[model samples]
Target: MADLTGSDLTAAKAQDDVAAPPSAPRRGGAAGLVRWDTAVGALLAVLLLCSFGFVGDFGNTLNLSFLIGNTLPMAVIALPMTMLVAAGEIDLSVGSVAGLSGAVMGSLWNAGMAIETIIPLCLLLGLVCGLVNGLLVTRLGLPSLAVTIGTMAAYRGIAQIVLGANSVTDFPQQYLDFGSGRIPGTFLPYAAIPWAVLAVIAVLVLHATGVGRSLFAVGASAEAAWFAGIRVKRLRLSMFAATGVVSALTGVFWVLHYASARYDNATGLELSVIAAVLLGGVDFDGGKGTLGGAIGGVFLLGTLENTMSLVDVSAQSQTVVTGVLLVVSVLGPRAGRQLARTVARRRSAGSGSAPAATG
Candidate 1:
């Protein structure tokens, strides 16, 4: 009888141990589902509802075209920005780079340069700027934040020097029309097509490709990535170059849409771009984000701006709202993590005590 009782107790204890592991996993899965459902899902639903309400014409095809057209420039740059942030870096010089590239294109055009010539030169200039940034940060072992901040000021200054308080408005009529034109008879803006395509490409690169996986690995831990044979420096340079090229492209798009390129175009836009990146769910510290989240973030910020404009909000007030939103978005994740840890601890304690009580 004694031996039987001992065997029964041992078997029950083993069963409980086995059950604990699976239960812990289930709880973890449940917590993740709850977090996603509560945070991302709820935020997205609210944005959709608000967008439709505010832009009543959102249901119309033309309205969709307009939204896409207006949003594409930001989207283009934001895609690469997402990648950069995922790798735990920031590029404050993007807006300045865009401004400078636009100025370069505009200046070349005004000098009677062919569109083909101007385009390639502008792209090259962007590439060079990116290269410099990568060299300064990686090769020189400087903090990216400091280096980019300096470059941001210098690049904008260069743009000003290139344009010298003048604006270029003599772009080819074809280019201007391309910027403003919609797809024939559909409200779909032609400008948006490129952006949409790029977004899809970006999604594929980040989610489907080995390079994307490498980027995540690098962002999660650069030393680990290097140890694993990833070319960390090369990847960083490539990312910087990609960012520059996209920013330049965005500059061209801006010039085309507005029919002019001023040295000051997109000034202070880096903040807006970064905000969109963070709002999209990229961690500031790196290693976690999605392009879809960034897209949603773009819509959120764009809609907020549009709404505020409609309500006659001051620029200062708008800035304040943005600042507040950024703070909340960033801090929200941390708070959630801490809460989850606390709950986990409590559950663990409860489970440990359950056997004691039964005994």
Candidate 2:
């Protein structure tokens, strides 16, 4: 063989290293599952324990059913909210949209429209609301935060205008039964079943599809994505539409469950949905979260609220708790970043000192 020169030796070594670098250790089954949002899980476990200790009958499945029933609508809305956030947008109008959709459906039903017409009409309304949001943000170049804030007020106002203080209660028995009904004589709520199914579908779409990956990419870096030929505007619009549609679905479910539709339906729910998404490990800055984590966040919030309610905690205090959690969730990542920097500094110092020690 010919004598190896310095450059040739360097190149050979680089190629070999690239071919045979050490593999990172893999987490095993249970540990792997817990790795996604260990913090959320810990909070949930502690809440569960406290709930059992403080509330009589909290251990029963019926209590769980009640919690599930209440939380299902929020969960459904949050799924699409997760996608919107992942795509670097937010929809503050979801609560109002949900309310409006329910009001519309109720009004139509009270007027004797068939269920078929009401359902499609509700879905179409969602699509329209979402499209408007998308237009304001994407076409007009308005900030989504501002646009959604305006729409939140506008939509809720529309809901009030539509129903005033009066409520629509003459829903068909089939809807009422399905909405408030449990699953086939079990304590499992029917409302929760649809939400669960929707959550699974949303998760699969967000995690297992190309569109999902692209949404994340756009959120992570919109300019970069645009340069890479992704249609950032269209995707953002679609996500907003999806959020509206999901919120509408939840609204319909609400009408079914309560047997009444009112302007106040799902009021102030936007915060809870966003809280669940953030607590689930989706960064507020965008482009990082899992559907499973969002679901976990929903469960965490649901448990906290249910436990609090059982103990007679005031709604105001619960809001405070959610606000605190939101702050902590955002801060936790910052704390981690600070800790990483500290560790990196120490490691650098150690490596520098190592040279002297060897010398």
Error of 2 at 99 (Å): 0.7
Candidate 1's residue-wise lDDT over 231-321, tens digit each?
A: 9889988999899888888888889988889999888778888887788778889888888888778777776675565557787898998
| Candidate 2 accuracy as TM-score | 0.86
**lDDT value for candidate 1?**
0.80
TM-score to true structure, per model:
0.86, 0.86
> For model 1, what is the alpha-carbon lDDT of residue 53?
76
Clashing pairs in 2: none
Top model by lDDT, which number?
A: 2
lDDT of 2 by residue, 210-265 (tens): 89999899989999999999999999988898888888888898888878899999
RMSD of each: 5.5, 6.1
State candidate 1's TM-score. Answer: 0.86
lDDT (0 to 1) per candidate = 0.80, 0.82
Q: Which residues of candidate 2, in runs, are more than 4 Å off?
A: 1-36, 49-54, 349-359
Which clashing pairs does model 1 show?
none
